[model samples]
Target chain A: MTIKDIVYIALFVALTAALGLMPPIAFAGGALPPITAQSLGVMLAGSVLGAKRGGYALLLFVALVAMGFPLLSGGRGGFGVLLGTSGGFILAWPICAAVIGHLVHKNANANIWVTGGMIAFGGILVMYTLGIPWMAVVGKLGLDKSLAIMVAYIPGDLVKVVLATVIARGLRRAYPNI
Target chain B: MLDLYTPGTSMLHRMSPGPKMAALAIAATALFLQESLLVTALAVVAILALYRVANIPMKTALAQIRPLMWIFVIFFAVQWYFSGLTLAAYVVLRLAALILLASLVTLTTRASDMIDSMTRALRLFKPIGVNPDKVSLAISLALRFIPVLGRIATEVREAQKTRGLERSIIAVAMPLAIRAIKMADDVSDAIESRGYRS
Candidate 1:
């Protein structure tokens, strides 16, 4: 409600959008292109904003897309894309945000690695679970192929998870309130 | 570096985070289910109206979207080239709508309030072996760090530029990485000192 909160929220929204500009990993012959640095923003939202606010930040981003802003990576947007092949992943943003927030809040004083892993795994599950089904239905791929394509994303996502964890933990050290 | 949120006092802002989230979920689902251009167009119009109702400044909204112009162009081109113009148009317009709507939400709500709402939602997961507290903490940490990382990145870039090493990835990246590592260590210590548990 205060000016500071408004300022921070605005900053995070821009940060999330800007980070989306990071080049996505293009896998040859895969069902989907795994975006690099995508989850970094997601993790950042949760870790910094805490459980509820973190998810809200992401929700804010998703709402923008629903309202027709081309803020997603690669300039994709609109309701149609949401129904397209990657709709599932798009839909998973809020859930992932909540999961990341919850994990970090619960282990507020835990080791960075454990907290990081929890957030990463939670994110991975949300994206993949939502993404695979859409891949199957929209892309017309079977479960096996959908799973295979989804699997290609794990390595790249893991790297993001680690980075998010490190950066978040580091920021906490630098600023106690965060 | 860009501030995309426009301050507003729309009904959306007054709406609780929980209901707003639910609405988004429902709308997103509807979007995915309806592939008709008519439906998509309607959705776009509805989002714009929400912006108006929310009292977001038009100039501010447009400015927020300006940076993304290039991405939209690239996507339009790629989709056009590979999937034809019609599909490209559809995809671009749809994505644009979503982004704008999200901007509206962020512009109105406070980050801390959003965090609290999420923590409450996840508390239901406690019975499923999930700890809402820990999860929320991690999310808070990540969200809080985004700006810090951005600041660190900018500082590193500036430092590199001063030495005429701006063009070198190593010059910018190395220090950023080092600082990030140091940051992680500090976070762990702070959490422990605060008497919080993992």
Candidate 2:
């Protein structure tokens, strides 16, 4: 990879963590992982950077988290956090970004709304695919129970899908070369 | 806190990146495998001693562990209710020891050195078409920019507050993303100017 690739990856890793700094909206009384904005970073990375760099960017962010930076939402990190309830969401970020990026790339010539739908498919559907089950296994709940907890975040995720689709479309329009 | 890599001459600062990383992995595995209070306390003490041998400041060490304390509280409270205080202590100690081990390694190792070592290890995957150098570079850059983006977020949030948009995730996300992409473009130009191509 060239320096440009490295920079793009770094920027998004930082973007993901930066998004985490904003306080999360608690879905309930904190039983489920609070809705954090880093998922927006995942969406933007995919919708903008496409599959390779987009996925690498989030994987890079996960590397830092693994390195013990408190970069996660709520400033949590380290190996221990890997065993926590939110670990599934954190680990799934790269895959989610990659899936989103892959689908968005397939529809690159399509209008923004179609690209937006792809983002939701990858970001929401694909993420929950791995995340909800991992939450069940790691958190030691029934799959049914985990799905029940995960249900709380659907509305917030839709909001992210809309926001990311808009920003991504606008970003590309203004800076076509990117 | 895994902040910027501070240059230092402490033993930790002097240690080789590879062994330190191995130690972190081993320590973490050991912590999880064993569940006794004796093992947990011993492990914690051993890590604290390693910190001293590495000459990390008490403040830096505590800062690394501080944010995690809240989660521990919840873990402790919940575990205490279910399994009694002894088991809870064992669990929390095991958890704390793992965090400290990760932080200690991170603090001691230089970012470039760690990346170089990782790149060397990742070379094993080259036959499968994975570019280790590129992966390591990405990880290095990500670590470098965590603080930069953080400052940008704070600045944007302040600006949003002025416009009464602070409460809006869209307001924060839109500008933050636009600015990040702009920064990425400028960086790409910088790289291109330096004769690097994707």
**For every model shown, what is its TM-score relative to the native structure?**
0.54, 0.78
B72 Cα displacement, candidate 1 (Å):
18
lDDT of 1 by residue, A118-140 (tens): 87766788778877887566543
Top DockQ: which candidate number? 2
Assess the local accuracy of residue B188 in candidate 2 as a C-alpha lDDT between 0 and 100. Answer: 69
lDDT of each prediction vs. the true structure? 0.65, 0.76
**Position A158, candidate 2: lDDT:** 91
Give the TM-score comparing model 2 with the true structure, all chains together. 0.78
The most accurate candidate by lDDT is 2
Kindly list the per-residue Cα lDDT of model 1 for residues B1-198, writing each as its tens digit: 222334455688788767775676677666657767677888888988887888876875575456456446655665677667776677667666665665666566655556677678768877876565655554555446666877888899998898999877556655775675456556666666777754
Go through the candidates in order and give the clash count of each: 73, 1
Q: Give DockQ for candidates 1 onward, in order.
A: 0.08, 0.46
What part of the reference interface contacts, as a 0 to 1 fraction, does candidate 2 reproduce?
0.59
- Among all windows of 10 consecutive residues in model 2 chain A, the one with the lowest summed lDDT is A134-143
Q: Lowest summed lDDT over 10 consecutive residues: which window, candidate 1 chain A?
A: A1-10
